[model samples]
Target: MPLYWHLLKAVPSLQIIAHRIVWSALLVAGWLLWKYGRGWLRQTLAIPRAGWMLALSGTLIAFNWGLYIWAVNAGHVVETSLGYFINPLLNVVLGVAVLHERLNRVQWTAVAIASGGVLWLTANYGSFPWIALALAASFGSYGLIRKLVAVPPVRGLGVESLYLVLPALALLLWGESHGDGGFVAHGAVPAWGWGAAALLVFGGVLTALPLIGFADAVRRIPFSLVGLLQYIAPTLQLLCGVLVLGEAFDRDRAIGFAFIWVALAIYAVDGLLRNRAAPALPG
Candidate 1:
């Protein structure tokens, strides 16, 4: 985590995102090749009418990555963390509004509690938690888009990166011409190589891990429980920001977090009740 903080410090947001996407595309592509072969790549590339639909998702994902990287780089890691905590609720709202999925009473209550927390945060801060809001909104929208799309996750990511790769490469070339490249120009050899390799692996590993976990949790647990755990990353980021970086944690923000905690508690209890009432799965 400290490593990640330092890593964020070392590179610009777009550069970090580009590296992450490139490595993620490579790693996921390799996995697909091993599992399904080049035919999978061809199929992914040949999505006829779906191309534009995917381009939209790709754009949202790019913004999400950019915002997250900016938060990390700009010393707003805690606020960024808060944003992720809000994302599940955003996803639920999207489901209700766009997919026409109906929320249970308990789910509604949970959303209300979460909304109160957000309201409290906004009111106390005298402005919306823009960092958090941007992160949550962009990511929630990205998730919604991904859900609507028919392509497999790995293939979708690969295609998205492929679409963006030319622009990314152009940026790299453009940066080099301006003598502002993060790769060789930023630091010393050992620092650059090891750091670069770590970043590449970090990009690929993070892409795969939470997604795999979410897939498993979705099958084993209720959506609400999965939603609750979505707080973990943000919580960790908040802690790291405060303890590690010593960022400001003011009274209103503290109160705001308190509200969010209360809301999460309400959400958790409501989920437990819902789960108790839900029919048991087949043996």
Candidate 2:
């Protein structure tokens, strides 16, 4: 994200998003084609429900990507980290509300604590943390939609990319014509030069690789483990925002974050205990 914020020095967030979509679409499409041949596309297109779900998820994730890019560049990295910190708890809420799932008392308590933290942030942290809420909402909704849809991660991402690619390409072309594009132009190189262009292009790999790896990891490991591991991202993001990027983390915000952190600790411990108590199936 910090790298993205740095890139924003040369490229606008919209263009970065467009490049991310276009190049990711091409890469994912190529990989799908190579591995599954043309039949995969046919098989995927046959699933109308999945397609619609992916479309909605794609839009939500696109909004998330754009918002995150803008927020980081706008010096709201700490708040962005807060969004991701809030995401897992929001997922718990969504599971109950949207999926009609049950939560244990401990889980409920965690949710309550996180909610209190958010409210405290809003009440005392100067302004309503809309950026954090929006990020959490957009990403939480995206995750929920993806979970409900029966699609493999890579293929799902491929379809989502396809849904956005046309407009992304159009946007890039428009930018290039207007001499505002960051990657390349008709005859002139981008003023930011080749390094930024390389990063812009590499953004596709950066976007797809982690998601693919994460999906594979989920398949191979216990989901509870994945849940526990999810904290690493926001933790590092918070560190980056505070230590690396030099963002403000005053006492009021620290208190608010402390509430959320305590909530997460409770949630994680409960999950671990529950997972351990459950009977293991024959391998």
Candidate 3:
């Protein structure tokens, strides 16, 4: 978030997103080529319904990335943190609704508590918490879609990057033509300097690695369990917003967040107890 805020000081969010997509496509392409040879693309393409599903997931993740970058740069890091905090519960809901995953009573209770927290925040928030809701919904849906699709992590991300790369390239080209590009300048003078340009390139690796890891994890674990673990990210994001970035965290917001945290704790404790009680598998 800090890196995005710094980069967006000199570059438009859309342009930054374009750079992310284009560079990520290059990185993923190279990885796919090296790891699976040239056959990976053909093999992925042969999967039933993979293309369209990945297309939808790609679009969703692009929107989520763009919104997060713009929100961070717009001095709404706290709200963005709230968005990610809410995402895990949303994932739990999605797991039950879309995947037909059954949740124990305690897990359901956690979801109810989280839902109440969101409602409380919305009702008293002075305005709709659209940023939080949108982020949670898009990302939760993205994870669900990725989980449903049969493609492997690297290849799924590769396909997603491929789907978005053309438009990203076009956006970059347009920005350059309009003298608003961040990576390169219209004249001799560079736009935003080479440092910013380098960061934009590095953004691809930052973007791709976590997503690949997430895709791999989502495939290996139950969707709701993945959601439970995701709190680690939002916890860090919240600290970054409140401590490092110095965003406001008043009483009302704190109360709402407290409710969500309590819910997460309940869900986590229930899972741990269930695991402890279950019989050990034969070694």
Candidate 4:
């Protein structure tokens, strides 16, 4: 992220993400080809079962990436933090709504308390926090879709990357037509420089690595424990937004965040007591 906006002065958010998908898809595809050869796509696709669901998951995850990059660069890092903060809670809602899953009283209480905080924040802000809501909803939906698919993490990502190839290519072409593409080999943008361009290419590897790790983590740990730990990312983002990015987070906003935090505490405790497992993300 620092490389894109701060150091390399990259192009628009869509372009940046498009480049990421291009490289990531290529990387994952190459690995799949070399490892699985003829059976690679066959094994990963698993149509009549997980195909449409994986495609939907792919779209949602890409949407999450593009929006997140936009939010960070648009100087809404704190709100981005807030979006991630509520992602797990949104997962709870999605599970119930989409998956027909049920919740216990503790979970219900947590949901109500979080809704109160979200409502309070929305009212206080006098407008819906679209960035936060978009982030949480997109990611939560992606997770839900991944839960329905039974592909391996790496292979699934490869297929998702496959699904995105056309759209990503189109975005890049559009950027080039407008003379706004920054990933060009002979451009003035810092990312166009050989060194920065190489790093930019490496972004694909960087992106997939975390998803791979997360896939492994969910497989090993209790879902509730995973829920307990998911806060680390958003918490750090919050601190970075407030301290590093210098976002305008005042007492009014803090009040809403406080409620959300309390709700998370209740949810986390409930998860610990229940020890339910969560589905792994396919990335």
- 180-223, model 1: which lDDT tens digit per residue? 55665553223576566466457757765555444344445434
**Candidate 1: Cα lDDT at 89:** 75
Worst 10 residues of 1 by lDDT: 215-224
Error of 2 at 99 (Å): 1.7
Q: Of the candidates numbered 1 and 4, which has the greater TM-score value?
A: 1
Candidate 2 lDDT over residue span 79-112, tens digit each: 8888887777777666677667677798788878
Question: Top lDDT: which candidate number?
Answer: 3
lDDT of 3 by residue, 198-252 (tens): 8889999989999999999999999999888988888778788889778888888
lDDT of each: 0.69, 0.79, 0.86, 0.75
* Candidate 2 residue pairs in clash (backbone atoms < 3 Å): none
Query: Across residues 1-283, which tens digit of lDDT does each residue of candidate 4 receive?
Result: 4324444445577777887899899898898899889788986666556677778888988999888887887778888887887787776666677667677898789778877887888778656799989998887777665666677788778888999989999988877776666666334364355665676588788778777676556545444344446667887888877887788988878998898889888977777665556665699
Q: What is candidate 2's local distance difference test score?
A: 0.79
True-vs-predicted CA distance for residue 72, candidate 3, Å: 0.7
Clashes of each: 0, 0, 0, 0
> Candidates sorted by lDDT, descending order?
3, 2, 4, 1
Off by over 4 Å in 1: 1-5, 45-49, 126-128, 187-197, 211-226, 279-283
Task: Report the Cα lDDT for residue 194, model 2.
Answer: 74
